[model samples]
Target: MDIAILVKLTSRAWSLNILASMNSGIPGRQAPLLAATSASRTAFAQSLDHLMQLGLLERNPGHGHPLRPEFRLTKTGAEIAQTATRIVQAVPDDTEFALLRRSWTAPILALTHRPQRFSALKSGLITISDRALSTSLQRLEDSAWIEREIDATLRHPFPTYRAVNQGFAVNQAIALVA
Candidate 1:
């Protein structure tokens, strides 16, 4: 499975619940499971169907009760789940850091000095939401490309940020871009 798809599925409460239930050898009761995971019945059904098509799950033969159908993971499903877990756990904390470094090249070169926030950085080169900008900043900071300082001027202040030594590489790349 694609890492992105696996990540999205694992992160969703309903999918994870279903996976966990299957892992534990308990067949999920569709309606109750959907209710517990706060997912729509249609969405839950779709996810289950997709898993089934992927050879990750199978519908158990109906027992005496025709109304209740049980679902269980195949051996391949267990292996996929294990692989997904390993991949997710192995992801670096600064997952977006490299992308952020590449993205900020132009702005970094244009700036006489580093900006205090990604909003300040984005103003010149690209349009991004405040939330996305903040996330990028956090990623850069986590990767040691930037450092944060307390801003004393703002009431109920936020941290001020500036590029660290690692940003020099980004600056150099930017200088070469044109």
Candidate 2:
């Protein structure tokens, strides 16, 4: 899965969680998804709508009442949902879910899989602002998901970031799908 695509899919809170829940065999109805993701009704509805707009999910025709439509993943959505499931499984607990929910965290972690400098990471996630990238890097470091190491071999030493611990697991999950 491309980082850009993943980032877009996860821009809304609970979107990834919703996909993971469905991929894990949960029923496609609203009630089950809402329960599985633990998202507020408004947020869940918005994420569901976002996914539908992206064409990753759609209303299941004739399978559910108009007031309670069921959803099914499109072909592209199923593949992405499988990746989302793996990434969710890699998270150690609910605390980490907050980090993953951030727009840049998962994409940043994925980029750090091979170790990258701040500028490199920012470039990889084209639209991220400097402050947003820096904040995300700090949060990931604080969570011990990534390590910042200063490289002295070069004439101008620079800090490099690499995924570690849970971040490594998530990166590996993304790698498997990619």
Q: Pick the candidate with the highest TM-score.
A: 2
lDDT of 1 by residue, 3-86 (tens): 233433433334544564455445456755565445577767877777776677777666324566766667878766554333
Candidate 2 lDDT tens digits, 82-144: 999998999959987788888888889888888799999988999899999999899999999
The residue ranges of model 1 lying beyond 4 angstroms of the native Cα positions read 1-13, 62-67, 82-178
TM-score each candidate.
0.39, 0.96
Q: After superposition, how far is residue 68 of candidate 2 from its true place, in Å?
A: 1.5
Q: At residue 103, give the lDDT of candidate 2.
A: 81
Compared with the true structure, the alpha-carbon lDDT of candidate 2 equals 0.91
| Cand. 2 TM to true fold | 0.96
Each candidate's clash count: 0, 0
